[model samples]
Target: MSSKSTQTQFDKNMEFGNDTTELIRYITKGDGAGLAYQWLSTLVDGFGHRMVGSDSLEEAIDFLVKSLEEDDFDDVHTEEVPNLPNWVREDDNVEIIEPRHQRLNVLALGGCEPANITGEVVVIRDLDNSKFVNVSGKIVVTAQQFKGYPQTVKYRQSVKLFESLGAIGVLIKSVTSFSINSPHTGSGAEGARIPAASLTVEQADMIDRMFQNGEKIVIRMNMKSHSENHTTTSRNLIFQITGAFRPVNWLSHLSFSGDQQHVNLFKMKRLDEIVHLLNRNGILLGLVNNPSQGDVRFWAKDGIPSVNYIPDKAIDYYFYFHHTGGDYITIFKDGDLEYTASIFAVLGHIIANMDNWGPA
Candidate 1:
């Protein structure tokens, strides 16, 4: 971290003490809380799921630009992100056909090329590419448990190897430790295009048990999802709070879709300063020097010191509702969203006010 003042970092708190204190108050306990959640409620409820190529995403972006501009944020705008991959879920049907009958919940993953196929079941509770067989003309059913999303999603999404082995389709157990028969959807890996859908954890486990008990299992996956048109249409919504000092030194509002989001601090001494500020103000969150995902990679690749704030209440239930029908505005606790906003508000204020970029 770089600083102009000779004072030690903690004493530097004296610099932002009064300003940050009031900013925290205004955001957490003042009208800002109501206004922030109001905007969030409108976006999540009014627009619904904002997947690429869907009208909901465009509407959500439009709403953000409009709301931010109306609030008089400086240089509020939407920038076009072109040539991105686009996938949309239209309809799906997953069912056990050979022995009795059951319909399973499903969400066709992003980047899954459309197909309709029926294959014999090969339930693999643990999947490893190097050690596998009997999946050539089968629906590979997986109930790989949740270790962590970054680790577990690989089993769910990485299907190129399975594709190469002549697997027709895949049904991944929702990548979460606990579930009430809720399915979770996410982006498939880059190369695998076989039709795939996420199955509820309960469904995957049941299928695995049936296979273990010597039952001849076969399933039919009839999907009508598409990404046929080559052109991908999406927007990166942005609003800039111009720096009063050092205009070239600016931070951005990080926007991401799907699971890839991370932040790396690059050993900036000023990072410590903001951590102290959050501690003083009583905001609890998980922090890491190098996290694995998109927001961090995008900024860090361009030599920018950006912070990706993921609000964790420590119970780790985020995956339970993500990308499913259960993903709703009601998931957030009272003042939860506002507190997150306050963390960014404080960091943005400090970063915008700094005279130099840190740890460059």
Candidate 2:
């Protein structure tokens, strides 16, 4: 063996000089496997669906921050989080008063203004192409289905659709297949608007029959709706790590740091969604779609709630590192459409050397 090889072996055997060993020791010991599992399982599965502003979400954030501090990370803190306003359903009722009076199924639209007075209901084909010019100050009924329910509902959205036409309120046929004489209430647009409600298919059909018979259909609507706005708390989480060093090539690497870069291939939880959406729109973002041709890497387990750090040195620094202009990355859950149908996100942390950077 050469003199350098023999000397390196002797140093390792005697534990004389090994800076790399110390760096690995710090990370592996600091974030042991068993401890990692415990921390993640307790947060994700145990807490289950921690919605923003909920007490459960706040508790989870507290747990995360405390755990980090326990691991000896310093200067850990949070940034302010913003969220949309909440709208809730209130009491609502609808009924046919003529051509055999009967109780009708009904639901109030979200954000509908409270009604201090009950009003007569008038059914019509369209609010814009209305045959009734002075139909204002009455509950207008229309037959149209609003798209994107639950996420972007429009069950009670007519308050704004016909308010300027002198409409005081609105009643729409429920946007569903089977009518159990049940009305479905959902979110409505903001501001001073008229109250809106829904009616069952049976009741709507009955109205259509009345219109066919040339009999004026009379109905009534009563609603009590309002809202309250207040400040609430939220959370933003982060996972961090240290970088590796090459003592032998330190001078050369530093001199080329600005131009040379690294290419990182991240496996997202929802990669399929990303691929499908991007392909559907005929858009490309420098990503390889096929798994066989893609970079092979290890991903953290579902039970492991924390982020994994994979060291990648294959990328040429001049062309790859920080090429996207942003530091965030995303992981898409392939089949899970219920929670984040399109993507899940992550951020990167690269350090010059472990000893140089620390908690701040």
- Among the numbered candidates, top TM-score falls to 1
lDDT of 2: 0.45
- Give the runs in model 2 whose Cα sits over 4 Å from its true position: 1-88, 131-134, 145-156, 176-182, 229-360
Q: Candidate 1: which pairs clash?
A: 1-269, 260-294, 261-294
Local accuracy of candidate 1 as per-residue lDDT tens digits, 1-360: 234543434345446655667888888887676777788788888987777777888988888888888888787777888887676678788899979799988878777777778889987766674245678888888877688777787877657767877888988888887788888888773467688888999999999899999999989988887775786868887777876555543366332223333222323456666666676677764455554444377765655454666666442577777777888888888888888887888778877766654343
Off by over 4 Å in 1: 1-14, 189-193, 244-249, 253-267, 285-287, 291-295
- Expressed as tens digits, the lDDT of each residue in 210-312 for candidate 2 is 7656876666666765554653557666544433342211110101111111212222312222333333322222233322221121211111112221222
**Candidate 1 residue-wise lDDT at 222:** 88
Q: What TM-score fits each model?
A: 0.87, 0.43
The global C-alpha lDDT for each of the candidates, from Candidate 1 onward, is: 0.73, 0.45
The deviation in Å at residue 102 for candidate 2 is 2.7
